[model samples]
Target: MGTTQLETVPEPKYWHLRTVLSNALDSEFEVGEILPNERELAARFGVARATLRQALEQLELEGRLQRRRGVGTTVAPPRVGVEVNPTRHSWPGAPGDAWQTEGCAEDVPPAVVGRALGRGDEKVYTVHRVRTVHGQPVATELLYVPPASVPGLSGIAGLETDAGVARGRAVLRELQRLELGGQERTVELGSARAEDAKRLDRLPGAPVLVLTTRYLAAGGTAAVAVSTYRADTCRLTFGESAGTGLLAAG
Candidate 1:
């Protein structure tokens, strides 16, 4: 009789450490509880400091841990849920909007953004916006609008010179003048760009949730907005019922 031999699966050390730490987090650690220093943790787990760090990195990416430069690592609190529903069509600057205008610039967008806007080589108006909750910055947005789409913006004040927050507001106000037919939104995983990282107070190449929205009008694509939310701090919810968890947490 021939016996069948089972193949043994080999698991990476960091992966096994991650599992152990995850269990510890669930059964022992409380939210905001400071974790032991890396050296101690490495020694306790009998692994290299780099391996322990790898486990912590995975936990942080999953929103289970938080690390600050000066402050040590701690168990992260639950992520804040932000809603993005489409029951009604409204411009970004509409009443009760959570974003704040930061600045505006007229320049050729990056190739990816220009491709999405269906305009290559032509200049577009870029507006910078930031969103916060509990005074902590959670997301940074870049809204692109072609000149032909917002013809009346030329008459708006401060667009040519300062391009400050006032100009951003003026551009949005002019954008709302057009009739919005519909909009499309998509979410994907992405790395933080340098400028976006500075805005979100994170290191370059940090994990982020990228949301791309395209606003349509009778003419065609009127605007395109790309919002980068800190994946470690945000849990995006959709629909009216999305507010339930947020309200309870608050």
Candidate 2:
């Protein structure tokens, strides 16, 4: 007869610490209230600084806390409810739109975008935009407008060299001249890429809601939009809503 040893799996200590800290946040902390220093919190929780930091990082990703480089950590307010669905279709820079144009460039889009637009290796107008709510940057968008959609773009003076708010406006005006029939949209979860992370002011690989939209004109793909929203700080609503509550459980 032989004795066999049982295999024991250990749960990650940081995961357990995250739960404890989350409870404290709900019951004991107020929004915008700063917490104790990391060293003090680590001591209070009887965990190593690294473990404490792991938990804190999770909290920040969940939008439960805001960590500033020089300001330390504080409780975060409720996430913003962004209306995504409307009764009608409109251009990106339409009046009262949430996004502000950052710059415009004529470059080749990502492979996925190229496939969507049915253009291979062809350069298009890439309009960079930043969407904000309460003055906080929440999303970044890269809009790829094919040459066929804006035939007059080349005729427009200073379009290639212009890289400002006005540049985006000009492009939008040219796009608006076309008859926009409708658009198709798809949403999925994705990790923030390097460029989007810098614009969103979050660490690379943070969770985000990626939205891909295709604008159709005269039965052809006119433009494509790829928007990455901060998953923790935004609650995407499909239509009109009542109160400001998280649309889904985190």
Candidate 3:
């Protein structure tokens, strides 16, 4: 009788498939390229349809793929970045600003925003925008301000969209009058939440740069702005080489 031996076969892993596909995309695919339809790709890889989809979803979350409801998934374009610090070299909202205006939204912000407003949550103005650089969407900005802090807001016409650098200046021009106080800013490691991830076109857990700034004016806090920037694509710059630097660290 011939000796019989049983050989155990390892189960296939879908994550391995995703890695293979991701590498292929980075090495060979062009931005906006439509990937092979799921059915075709799954058959080619000898993987189940569900397994193939799992891989695709991860790619889409990483902003590597753009999936449409009906148009199919395409390769994602690059992301944009906007500098959030007030450096001597670059003001907050200056002409030739790296970020282009996306739009503004007025809403009651989160509880933290309410605390920043000091009204316990009554006053709020949220300016929503997508900051881009070199034609990529790298960050999303939500600027919140209490109405009392922005006393002359109505007079500061059109700053939200077409105001340009001068608009930021005009909005902040009053700072010089209200005792021109100091400010506190914090930078921290963070991940993009679902909403921010959607706007920034990255995964929910993607690394991000979170800059929280509290502006002080007229013996009180004027505004608090939280800017979420993509870590993979941006390097936040602060201070200038030549000018007199006037930033207070807190």
Candidate 4:
């Protein structure tokens, strides 16, 4: 590979190094290829290890690289395009949904969810799900359903066994029985919580995209879903029939 020595520039040295490294990534690296260690990278670029670390962190945040726990930093795959607008809207767990049911339990939802459901301080059936692409987990979802929304669901005693998974499916089935209404959704940038970070194989406080959806039925909010997606590996797209192509981050 060719080396480009840094010249005096107005920008910070680390910032200039980040741009050089990014150009190298585009010209020389393939997806899933491990990058050189910090020492080698710093030496190659004629920069200190601290400067290299800053550049690597910036690249990782920009979705051009991934730093795994046991694995070294590698070129990340193109960001998965997640459609935020569909031509047809359906309930969660509907046919062809990418998320897999993990478990379910009765718990008090957060105050925001309670406000959306108009049920304050009441226990609701919370279903946990993980969304994967090409066998890699990319997002985690928590769906909260008030008892009044799924009155027919029963026999869910625990959330740590096979029965728990079955109960989760049952809750989804019961949810489908409701008359189709409408839904509202909002997306925001956030830091991954500890539990979500564990599920996504990221450090605590990693950047994430939080999507909140409120499903309406029977003249009230029937369910609320909060999905946390890895900002580095997923890009939310808006439009029906939008292709799954990663857009360049500005």
**Cα error, candidate 4, residue 44 (Å):** 2.5
Report the lDDT tens digits of candidate 1 across residue range 1-250. Answer: 1111122326777777877788788778877788999988877777789978998998887878878667799777667665566556688898867899999988898898888778997889999999875555779998999987788988865568867898888889989999999888888989999998988879999999998889999857889999998878877778766554343221
Better of 1 and 4 by lDDT: 4
**Leading candidate by lDDT:** 4
Model 2 off-target regions past 4 Å? 1-55, 82-85, 242-250
Q: At residue 102, what lDDT does model 4 achieve? A: 95
Residue-wise C-alpha lDDT for candidate 2, range 1-250, written one tens digit per residue: 1111212316677777777788787778877788999888877767789987998998887888888667789887667665466456887777756688888888999998999999988998889999875456878999999878988877988777887777777888788889989888888889999989999888999899998889889988999999898988877767546234344324
RMSD of 1: 7.5
Sequence-dependent TM-score of model 2? 0.75
Overall local distance difference test of candidate 1: 0.81
lDDT of 4: 0.84
Ranking of predictions according to TM-score: 4, 2, 1, 3
Q: Compute each candidate's TM-score over C-alphas.
A: 0.72, 0.75, 0.57, 0.84
lDDT of 3 at 113: 71
lDDT of 4 by residue, 94-118 (tens): 9878789998888999999999999
Clashes, model 1: 0
Q: Cα lDDT for residue 9, model 3?
A: 22
RMSD of 4: 3.1
Question: Which regions in candidate 3 have their CA more than 4 angstroms from the true location?
Answer: 1-12, 79-91, 96-109, 119-124, 132-139, 147-211, 216-220, 227-250
On TM-score, the candidate that comes out on top is 4
Pairs of colliding residues, candidate 3: 79-136, 79-137, 80-136, 80-137, 80-138
**What is the overall TM-score of model 1 with all chains considered together?**
0.72
